[model samples]
Target: MSTQNYLVISALGKDRPGIVDALSKSILEFGCNITDSRMTVLGGEFAILLMVEGNWNTLTKMEESIAGLEQQLSLTIIAKRTEQRDRSNPFLPYVVEVVSLDHPGIVHQLASFFSKRSINIEDMATTSYAAPHTGTMMFSVHMTVGIPADIHIASLRDEFMEFCDAINLDAIIEPAQR
Candidate 1:
């Protein structure tokens, strides 16, 4: 059996129409399948994170063409080889949500909470906006974390709630539906 070759690529440039089209077309031409991707406009910049998989030769050919692609698309591209994540000590996925008045260090504090417990944050996103009616600046965080199966759910929930309370954040921790 042939092993799969995986490449993770990040492209950032000024936001524009057809960036995805151009990049994806190149991947298709090189015979690679885009396994995962996250594309978003951050301020004036368009950022992309993609994982593509193919056979060794096809991936190499694609890598060789990245420089030209960058020039054509006006993107700064970075690519690296990676393997599938190891899940030997698998985690039970949990979703965490937090909302509070906008302030500094919220993300950092939340990360510290999980890091201290050796929890893995698999995905996270945050946004700030004006609160409806009140017009107060509000911040919200959504994160997916990996909890070790050995950890007791009830105790973790209680601790997380209390921690949020101390920080004046309204939050919830629940098992991820998916």
Candidate 2:
């Protein structure tokens, strides 16, 4: 017997206790096996991104099995085949981490900077914690981005420094190894 291929499934909604139970039940009903997954609660919302393997033709059935889950949990579900091309090595991989006092427009500024350079942000996570008595908020963000091999890292670093100075935020960029 050969191993079955896999598809990726992503779901997100308000944070709740039963989201995983509901999701697992649906996956089991379609005879799909979840090989790897990452689930996290961000700002009161639960997000799950999973990699599942099953019969190639079972994609549609798997989707249907989870359709009602959206209504039951009031969540959004997205399922798609994990394309082989997307699994290949990247041309250039890099990481950018930012930490600073909580403020608006940070994401917008950083995202726009990367977008202008044709960089692709593959994954990103951000969180903020407020100090109980100090009334100061701390913000932190981590992102894995892919850039073309032709782009210059030095130039990117310089631009990021300028951005950091303007926003009074500290930023760091470094090459990410595969």
Candidate 3:
């Protein structure tokens, strides 16, 4: 069997219709599979992260096309070859959610809390908006973390709650529903 090669591609450009179509069409033409992708519009810009899988030659061909694609799509494109991920540690996936008045440092504080415990944050997203009726600017965060197998869940939960309380942020940490 031929070994499959993977490439991680990130593209950013002004928001427009048909960007996804054009990108996906190019990948298909190169005989690559879009194994995973995240596409979003932030303000007036479109950003995308795609993980593509193909045989070595096809991936190389795709890489060679990036410069032209950038011109064609008016996007800044970056591609890097990567190996498939293998989890080295047995860890539980937990989802963390937080809500509070929008302010600086909430994300930083949350990151510090997890980093200090050696937990891995797999994914996260944050948003700010006006609260219903109150017209208050509110910030919310959703994160997925990998908790080491050896850590006691109850103790960690207690400590996390205490940390949130001290910071005056409402939060919850729970095992992810697979």
Candidate 4:
């Protein structure tokens, strides 16, 4: 029987080309399969988070070589052993969209609202830009959320709308098409 090892890898460094190429080469050479990953530019830094799967021996080898990779790439790297996660989730998926004048605390407020209801925010991306004609600073948020099975969808949607209205944000909450 073959045993599998899961690893959570994160790296951050000054933004530059070849970051991904270097990391991918190391992972491939180490015989780890990239399962899921998110890479983005945050300010002047390039950040990467990935889930990799390999046999126990391969994973150990990767772990041992991570320090050298970090030094070579001038990155801050962190890796941790992770167990297989349960794929079954009872929560229903929903997409949330919000747009309004740019300001602080928007994400915090949304997180507070969801935490109060025991809802899980799975993935979210937010950006700020100037409105084409108005030249006003505008913020947009798109998020995937998981509503608990015990929650009432209609009531939750209504409450969310009310909260957004109070905050002067145009918002929409709808079932996500998977």
- Candidate 3 lDDT over residue span 1-178, tens digit each: 5399999999999999999999999999999999999999999999999999999999999999999999998999999999888788799999999999999999999999999999999999899999999999999999999999999999999999999999999999999999
Q: How accurate is candidate 1 locally (lDDT)?
A: 0.94
> Lowest summed lDDT over 10 consecutive residues: which window, candidate 3?
82-91
Candidate 2 Cα misplacement greater than 4 A, ranges: 1-8, 71-76, 80-82, 85-89, 131-133
Cα miss at 41, model 3 (Å)? 0.8
Clash pairs (backbone) in predicted model 2: none
Please give, for residues 52-158, the per-residue lDDT of candidate 1 as tens digits: 99999999998998899899999999999887778899789999999999999999999999998889999998999999999999999999999999988899899
Best by TM-score: 3
User: So what's the TM-score on candidate 2?
Assistant: 0.77
> Stretches of candidate 3 above 4 Å error?
none
Displacement of the residue 9 alpha carbon in candidate 2, Å: 3.0
* Higher-TM-score candidate of 2 and 3: 3
Pick by lDDT: 3 or 4, better one: 3
Which pairs in model 1 have colliding backbones? none
- Native-to-model Cα distance after best TM-score fit, residue 22 in candidate 2, in Å: 4.4
**RMSD to native, candidate 1:** 1.1
Candidate 4 residue lDDT tens string, 29-67: 999999989999989999999999999999999999888
Error of 2 at 157 (Å): 1.4
**Model 1: per-residue Cα lDDT at residue 34:** 98
